[model samples]
Structures are given as C-alpha cells and as structure tokens.
Target: MTLSEKILARASGRDQVRPGEIVTCKVDLAMMHDSGGPRRVAPYLERLGAKIWDPSKVVIASDHFVPPPDVDSAEILALTRRFAREHEIESFYDMQGICHVVLQEHAHVLPGMFAVGGDSHSPSGGAVGAFMVGIGATEMAGVLVTGEIWVRVPESWLIEWHGQLGEGLAAKDIMLFLCAKLGMSNDYKVMQYAGSAVTALSMMERLVLCNMSAELGAKTGIIAPDAWTLAALREGGHEVGDDALRWQSDAGARYERHLEFDAGALAPQVAAPHSPANSAPVAEHGGVRIDQAYIGACTGAKLSDLHMAASVLKGRKVAKGVRLLIAPASTLTTREAAADGTLATLVEAGAIMLPSGCGACAGYGAGVLADGDVCIASTARNFKGRMGSPGALVYLASPYTVAASAVRGTIGDPRDLLAMKAAA
Candidate 1:
C-alpha cells in the first residue's frame, strides 16, 4: 500500500484500503486559521451543544487578518482568541504566522498522521508524510464535533523528478512547470512526488511542492518520510518516533500514473494571470513591466525563500517605479532572516517589509494591487481578482524571479541577475 493508504487504514482500523473505497478514519490532528477557525465553527458547535472532540489534537493560528485592519477583522480575531481560551486549547498560535508555516515551525505535524485543515493549502502538511487535506467550514466544523471523518481513498500519481536543479531555479519552478503540463484537472487523485531531485530538497522547498497541489486540483500532495524528513522534524524540536521513517510507500507501490522529468534541463518558469496552467519558461514572458514585486504567502515567504530573493537583490535596488514587498511566512522566519542579515539586504535594496501573515495573498489586509496594476508575486495562486482589483494582473513566479523582476521592473529571468552577480 502507499503511505496514504497505510495511514488511512490504520486510522480507520483496517488491514488495508484500496483506491475508490470509502472509509471513516479517526483524525490524529485538525488545524484551523483565524479566517476559518472559531468564527466559522463556533456557531455550528453552539447549535449542536457540542464541544471540540479533542482540543489537544487541534492546532489553531490567527494568520489571516492578523494585524486587524478594521473593526470587522479585529472582531474575528477576538472571537478566535475567545474560542481557544474557552475551550482550553493551549496549542493556539496567535498572530505568530500562517497556520501551515506555524505548524511546521512548532512540529505539530508528524509522519503517519491523519490530519485535516480548514484552508485549501492544508496539503502542505503532506510534505512531512501526513495524509492531510483541506475541507470546507462545514466539514471542518464536523471534524471539530466528531474526530472521525469519511474519505474516499485516492489513487496516487507519481511525479518523479531526477537530476539536479539548475542555479536560479527552485521547487516553485518545478511546480509551475507541472501545473501547466498536467493542467489542474486531477481530482480524486493524490499527487505524490519522488526521485533524486525531490529527495534532495530541503523541507522548506518540499513544502512548496505540496502546498501548490491544490493548484493541480489533486486531493492532496505527499512525499514519503525519509532521513531528511525525519531530521527536519527532529531539528524543529519534535521527538520523532523511532519508526517515523517507516511511513513510506511500499516497493513497487501501485500508481495510476507515473510521470518522469529531468530537473537539470528545466528552466525557471512563470504562470500568467488567472491560471497557474498558463505557465511557460521565464523567457517567454520577458520584458513585461510590473508595478509591484511581492514576496509573501505561506508558499513563498519562508526563511529559505527570503534568502533566495536576497541573493538576487543583494547589490541591486528595486526599479524606480516598482514596489518590492517582503512578507515573511512567519514571525520566526522574520527573526531568523534578520539575524542572518537577509532582512537588511532586502531592505537595502529598497524593499518594504510587511508583517508576517497571509497578507495580500488572498486579497486581504495590505499590499493589494490597484486597478490595472501588473505585479509579479511569489504566492501560490494567481486567480483573477484573488489578490486585489479584478482589473489587476498578477503573475506567479519563484522568489528568485520575483526579486529579479523587482530589480528590472519587468518580468525578467533570474538567471540574468544571477549570472551578472557571478561575473561581478
């Protein structure tokens, strides 16, 4: 059985589970954010006179509307705190970071666990081998009332990437290439990543691959736990179990589809406005000017991601007319970046740093683009009007590309900047 099948089987008290089978599984963890947490679930729980099935098994974060830009947003945050305090949920992370990044920072997720999150990017948990997926507000409330939820076992699709990634490219580039090649029609299937390139990636990069699985329309994305995965959890202060590495797909595991790619041959990619499926090589979209270059969101604003941006922006400045905004994924990410001088490099490049939250990624809080604005961003999604005015055009790319674009004031390749810096 695949890792997902094995975990689901254990959670459901079964010997095995097959693709297309429906089963009720006990949840090992449930995660929620301010936007979708207490405010969304409190009313249903009150109506049913129910309490959280297991507060200890839950983790909540106030990521969205973090700085509370208005009264309505502030009230939402207040309700989130009240709900956690009233329920005695000690695992609540308030304004600490995006829920997904916060959980990884604190090691709340582990291999072989069955987890669910209230946000669409929940599959980010799968980077560490958890069988995690996203659910709606009603479905999340149901999980809160009862720790068991039903799921349809999905067939796995293996996307094996080999060779080595070229400089100035990253996991975000790999995922953008996939979104265009595979198109986002993979419903009821799991997008499983494997091979040398994926295994060589750091946990932060692996998180990017799984976090964007939602863009592929897959049920979730996951990677089997390896020494790298276990080590990351351990470094994050988790007392990883001895058998944590055992959570992997069996040899010759069945997969509905197996696709292979040569990572070394791939170039940096960028997705055009309205769809990640409009991706192409960076050269294809070159010379298109941008008003803003944003590096933020759970998918793009991690510490490592910030380092990538800093590398390109080191001795450069943002284009005279372009606004460069950097929003670290978490407060912890900000502190680490600052300590290492990455934050200074970015600021010296004329980048404006924003609070660490899900800012401007969902058209919430600050950094929203104005009408007819054209921006290059490092966030995962680029749906029309999702980041601001429907008239604004948002292009999605990696931190390297976004930073390079900021320096050029246009959608240019990061390799240009990297190569020039190397020569310098």
Candidate 2:
C-alpha cells in the first residue's frame, strides 16, 4: 500500500486496505474555523445531545472573518467561543490567523494522524505526513459527535520531481505547473509528492505545496516522513519518536498513476483569472498591468514567503497606481517576520500590513479589488469573484513574482528584477 493507504489502514484498525475501499477511521484531530464552527455547533448539539466526543482533539480558531465584518459574523464567532468555553476545549484560538498555521505551530496535527477540518484547505497538515482531509459542515458535525469519519481510500498518484528549482521559482510555481499539466481532475485520488526536489523543500514550502491540493480537486496531498519532517516536528514542539517515522510506503506499494517533472527547467508560473489551472509562464504575460498585489493566506503567508517578498521589495517602492497588501499566516509568523525586519521592509516599500488572518484572500477584511481592476496575488485560488467584484481579474503567482509585479504595476517575473539587482 501507499503511504496514504498505510496511514488510513492503521487508523481504521486494519492490517491492509486497497484503493476504492470504504473505511471508517478514527479521527485524531478535528478542526473548525469561525466560518464553519457556528453552523456545525447547532447541528452537532442537536444530533449528539451536546456531548462532544473529545474536547482535546477539537481545534477551533477564528480565521475566515478575524475582526468580524458585521454583527452576523461577530455572532458566529461568539457562538463558536461559547461552544469552546462550554466544552472546555483548550485548543481554542481566537483571531490567531489561519487554522492550519495554528495547528502546525502548536503541533496539534502530527505524522501518522488522521485529521479533518471544515475548510477545503485542510490538507495543509499533510506537510507533516498527516492524512488531513476537508469535509463539509454536515460531515464535520458527524465527526465532532462520533470522532470518526468514513472515507473511500483514494488511489494514489505519484508526482516525482527531480533536479533543483531555478532562481525566482517556488513551490507555488511547481504546483501551478502541475495543475496545468494534470488538468485538476483528482476526484478520487491523492497526490503523493516525492523525489529529491520535494525532499529538499522546507516545512513551509511543503505546506504551500500540500495546501493547494484543494485546487487540484484532490482528497489530499502527502509527503512521507523523513529526517527533515522529524526535525520540523521537533522544532514545532512535537515529541516525535521512531514509531512516528515508520509510516512509509511498502517497497511494492502500488500507484494508480505516476508523473515526473524536471524542477530545474521550471520557470515562475502564473495562473490566469477564473481558474488555477489556467496557467502560463510568468514571462509570457509580462506588462499586463495590475492594480493590486497581495501576499497572504494559508498557501502563501508563511514566514519564508514573507522573506521572499521582502527580499524583492527591500529599498523599493510599490508603483504609484498599485496597492500592495501583506498578511502573515499566523501571529507566530507575524512576530517572527517583525523581529526579522521582513515586515518593516515591506512597509517601507509602501505595503499595507493587515492582521494575521485570511485578509483579502477570502474577500473579507481588506484589499478587495474593484471592477475592471487586475490583481497579482500569492493566494491559492483565483476563481471569479474570489477577492471581490466579479468584474475584477485575479492572477495567482508566488510571493516573489507578486512583489516584483507590485513594484512594476504589472505582471512581471522576479528573475528579471533579481538579475538587475545582482548586476547593479
């Protein structure tokens, strides 16, 4: 069996399982954010009689609408808080940024665990080898009540990346390129990332890669635990032992499909408006003027992402007609960026800093684009009306490309800017 199959089999108390088989597995962790928490609360209480399966395994965070856009949103948050308090859940995080980031920073989701969340991007936990899947509110409520979820074992699709990534390229670019190549049709499949290139990525970069599994219509994305994974878990305060490191695919593990890519040949990629798979090389779309540039969200707001943006924006100013927005993924990352002067460098370049939440990515708090405007964003999704008006256009790219475009007021490649800086 594949790594995912092995993990699912263990969670379901089975020695082995095959693809397309249905299994009810014990959930190690259940996450709910403000957007889905309120809705699940009433149904969960009504269905399960106000008794939670386990409070310690439940994580509730206020992220989608951080400051609460209106009374309705505020009440939703209040309801979530009330539920957490009544249940005495110690994992409640209020306005602490994205739930996935909080989970990682607190080491709530560890390797060889089965996790489920209300939001679609819950696969971000797979960065640490956890099988984290996103389900709807109804399913989430059921899991909250019973502490179990029934999932069909997805066929595994192996994506092997060899060689080193080129300058100005990022994990975001690699995913976009893969989305374009794979056509985003992973209905009953899991994306299994491997090879030297994938192993070389940092924990944050791997998180960015797995977080976009939603865009590919995948059940989730996963990387087998390795030495780097162990180090990352320890750094995040998780006391991982040899048992956790034993969750690897068998030698003869089967895969439904396999694809390989040369990471060294990749260029900075950009997805056009309306779809994440509608992508092209960044240099192919240069000079497409942009009105806004944003870098934040679960897929793009890590401290390393901020550092990349800062490196490009340092000693430079955002273009006259452009509005640059920077949002960190978590309070922890925000503090780290501030201490390292990444926040200051971005601010000095005229970037507006927002709270460590979804920000403009979900079209909730700030940096909403107007009709007829074009935006270059480091966010995961670029569907119509994702960032505001349906008439507006949103292009998705890496933080480096977004910051470079912000300085030029157009879709631009970071390599060009970086090369010029090196020459100077």
Considering every candidate listed, which one attains the maximal lDDT? Answer: 1
User: lDDT of candidate 2?
Assistant: 0.89
Give TM-scores for every candidate, taking all chains together and pairing residue i with residue i.
0.99, 0.98
**Poorest lDDT segment (10 consecutive residues) of candidate 2:** 38-47
Candidate 2 C-alpha error for residue 173, in Å = 0.3
- RMSD of candidate 1 to the truth, in angstroms, is 0.7
lDDT per residue for candidate 2 within 1-424, as digits (tens), equals 8999989999999999999899999999999898877556666677667577998899999998778878987888888888788888899999988998888888888888999989899999998899999988878878878899898999998899999898778899989998888777778788989888899999889988789988899999998888888888888887889678788878899999988989999999999988889989998889999989999998898898998898888889999999998889999998999898888999999998888888789888778889998999999998899899999999999999999999999899899788777788
lDDT of all the models against the reference?
0.94, 0.89
Q: Tell me the deviation in Å of residue 321 in model 1.
A: 0.3
In candidate 2, position 397 carries an lDDT of 96
Q: Judging by TM-score against the true structure, name the best candidate.
A: 1
RMSD of 2: 1.2
